[model samples]
Target: MIRAVGAAIGVVLAIVLASAAWVAVVSSGRVHDVADAPDAPVVIVLGSQVRDGKPMKFLSGRLDAAIEVYDSGRAQAILVSGDAHGRSGNEIAAMTEYLVDAGVDRDKIVGDDYGLDTFDTCARASDTFGVSKALIVSQGLHVSRAVALCRDAGIDAHGIDAECECNWLAVVRNYAREWLARPKAVLDLLSGRPPAVVTPPDGTLTAVSRG
Candidate 1:
């Protein structure tokens, strides 16, 4: 019985390691610094926690990176994707307000309130918003998974690492969490489940593209 349990544990560990490596490989050569990031129709800022209508540090870092991309003329618009119904706060509203304050034109910023997770954000960006190519902005530990999942969702997606002043302990914790999250991302793809919330194409991106 002990040997069987040990073997099962080993298998699980191997699977976890392999999945993490796979995600990293998929995103290899796809992450870029702001200056090197390629031009695209839009930049997708993934959501994080918000408090009292204010973006948390990590989320602000992502928005800052997206702003850099916009200012560089690499992207024509910004898509802030997050949970509108999150208990912490309305992440979409917080993200939108942050961008507007940063001088991003209000019309060039679109919000996806149903982006409850990384996969949902990517899937919805492709299916619901008709986004073909985009730059995804997130922290270093998360950019690989975001890029991998976005590619799997059929978006020509690349990633930018959002710089934030996180302590070593928090950074290590986030990296460890990412290893576990990558396997679930793989499962999400293999299961072929649709995004939890689907809606008609909003024409938001179309308007942005026109401008």
Candidate 2:
């Protein structure tokens, strides 16, 4: 009985990993292009890690991709959302700086300093900023998840994929991580509320407003 139970557990783990592999395989090849209907509004550049007060190489590529979409005239505004958690590190400021350096006008940039994660970013974008819809930008594997959560939050979002031009090895690494994240995301969604907002000492995130 012990052996049989162990075998069954192994099979389940294999299935879970296999499903993520399949999702990565099919979703990897997909990407969204800039096709602004002459009036597409804000283009959100989903934030990535910025270590040592600088844009990581992969993050740089994403910022560049978002700039291209913005320059294509599809979006009038650019939203940079990420963790501005704790006074020690700030992802939003880093993202905003990248936008400025990429030739996106400073005024056109909106910093979502409170966005601690993908779910938080989308939820806050709609609930706090009053954005019902906008073009969401991220790599294909990640973008789909972002779009999925945003849709759940009542945001009319259009995901503009940016993974095609990404480094395949890096994307593969991300896809692998998504396998684990996918289960948690599903659980969070089923539980229903926006996964309880995370608040920083100085600004927005929590519903109570520590400020």
Candidate 3:
């Protein structure tokens, strides 16, 4: 009986800790424009899963929002960060294609296919490319975490409101999952090499240069 009681307590503690970690970084005020403030070398587009090189609905939403921000003169350049596990299955590539389709200049889009995870993506931006201040585009629920992660990595970052919660159920589920993801993000800051500047190679997402 005592063992069972201890197990239950452990479970509850884990959940509580996760929830607190998530709440510590979230805020309704984080949604803002990175443009018209200061010039940032790059705008890091966070990764989301793709389907056969195509963006899933959620992923598309982020791309669409980022495109709008791009069009509005918010940022001069875009960096698509995502998994490049497959030669053809690349989220950043899909995102670049989407942006180009929406009339964004091809030269402004940069792809960072090495960002396999959120922390890696942000760190790569700060360390790999010398991005100090950047606008992270994602769903409202996710932007806070992105901003927090960027700050943790010693980069000045802010979030722009890119996703809406039309479906409360999905939003709640994302929030729930984020609770646990926050701690891992914290750990990422504690581990890794120092930041370094990397210049992005020039290439269009679907083979067309905006220039």
Candidate 4:
């Protein structure tokens, strides 16, 4: 019985992993660059690690891509979404600062401090921020999942790759993580779990507030 149980568990794990791999395969090529991304009113700049109040290389690349899209007139506004659990440690703050410093209008950026993950950001973008469509910015491995989540959240969305060549480790790590994440995303959508945060949609907040 013990050997049988172990074999069954192994089989289950293999099936799960295989399903995840399929998800990633089908989800690739969904993320596009600024010139190729479909038009949208807002670009959701997905958050990443920050250090010393600055965006790390990966996060910086995402901001740069979003800014490019905005400058190119592909989008009118940007929503920087990420975890902001503690007062002193906020990814959105760093993202906002980076964008503004990069010459993006301060008023053109909005911060979603409660977006703890891709799903949270997408849900809030639709339910709270009233974002009907958006271009998501993140690494190639990540943008596909982001596109899937945002679409699940009722937003028409596309993804733009933000992965930096300098962060090869990030590429490997994110791809591994995404393998698991893609499968989980499908389950989460099916389970109908609500996001961590939501606010009544604010129309003006959806617009360029500071510019």
Candidate 5:
């Protein structure tokens, strides 16, 4: 029994190691510096948590990066993908307002309010929004998985590392979460799971242009 338990433990460790290595290998060179990727036309800003209708620091970093990319002409349109009306309120509303307040034109901002997760955001970007290629914006720790999932969803996707100002503890937590998340992200791609919200063919569920 003890030997069997030890074998099971070894298998678990091996799986973790393999998963981590897979992410590292697959993600290398897929994320570029925002300043260097001036040709990317559309950017997808993945969602993070919002508190009191304000973006948390990481989310702010993503928004800032997207704004910078847009202003620099690296991207013409910015898609803010997040929960529309979740328990924490409307992430897309907050994201859109933040961008508009920061000088991004309301007409140029497309809000994907149903992007409840990274997978959903990527899937909907292509299937619903009709986006063929995009730059993803998120913290460095999370960009790899974001890019991978987006590519799997049929969008020619790359990522730009967001400017993260998170504390050490938060950074550690983010990395830890990502290690687990990477595996799940790959599985989600292989499984071809449907998005939580599907846009109607009549274009009724189109991206919200606050303009």
Candidate 6:
């Protein structure tokens, strides 16, 4: 019995390693610096924690990157995806307010309040928002997984690493979280689970001016 359990553990560990490797391989050459990122119809800013109606540090970095993309004209619209029902405050509202305060046109922004996770964000962008091609913005440790998941969800997706002032300890913690999350992301793709909330394409994204 001990030998059988040990062998099963080995198999699980191998599978986890393989999944992480797959994400890295598939996302190679797809993550670019802000200057090199390709133009796309929209830039998707994945959500993070909100504090007192403002984005926390990591999420602020993501918003800042999206702002840069918007200013460069590489993306015509911005999609802020996050949980509206967050315990602290409404993440979607906070994200939108941040962008508007940064001078992005309110009309050019759309909100997905049910983007509860990375996979759900990608899936909803494809199915509910009618986004075909997009640049995903996230922190360095998380952007590759976001890019891979978005691509698997049928978006012609690329990624930009958001800048953050993270301490070494925070960085290490985030990397550990990412390592464990990759296998779950792989399972999510293979399982083909639909997002928790599904709505018809509301034409909001399509209506944004591309010029």
Largest TM-score belongs to which candidate? 1
Q: What is the Cα-based lDDT of residue 70 in candidate 1?
A: 95
lDDT (Cα, 0-100) at 172 in candidate 4? 83
**Clash list (residue pairs), candidate 5:** none
Per residue, candidate 6 scores C-alpha lDDT tens digits across 138-161 of 987599999999999999999999
State each candidate's clash count.
Answer: 0, 0, 2, 2, 0, 0
Instruction: Give each model a TM-score.
Output: 0.96, 0.75, 0.75, 0.86, 0.89, 0.95
Q: Quote model 4's TM-score.
A: 0.86
**Can you give the lDDT of residue 103 in candidate 6?**
100
Sort by TM-score, best first: 1, 6, 5, 4, 3, 2
Residue by residue across 30-126, what tens digits does model 5's lDDT show?
8877776646668899988888998889999999989888888777788889998878778898898999999998878888888999999988888
Off by over 4 Å in 6: 1-5, 209-211
Off by over 4 Å in 2: 1-31, 34-39, 86-88, 163-169, 198-211
Tens digits of lDDT, candidate 2, 1-211: 9999999989768867765564444334333664442334666677777787776766666677678877877667777887677343577787788778878778777778767777778777777766766777876567767767777778767677663455779778888877667656556666776635644332222221111
Worst 10 residues of 6 by lDDT: 202-211
User: What is the clash tally of candidate 6?
Assistant: 0
Q: How well does candidate 3 match the true structure, expressed as C-alpha RMSD?
A: 5.2
Q: Estimate, for each residue in 1-211, the C-alpha lDDT of model 1 and write its tens digit.
A: 9999999999989989888888878899999887788989899999999998999888998999999999888899999999999999999999999999999999999999999999999999999998888999999869989999999989999999889877888789888888888888989998999999999988878679668
* Poorest lDDT segment (10 consecutive residues) of candidate 1: 201-210
- Arrange candidates, best lDDT first: 6, 1, 5, 4, 3, 2
Specify the poorest-scoring 10-residue window by lDDT in model 3.
202-211
Candidate 6 positional error at 80, Å: 0.3
Give the Cα RMSD of candidate 6. Answer: 1.5
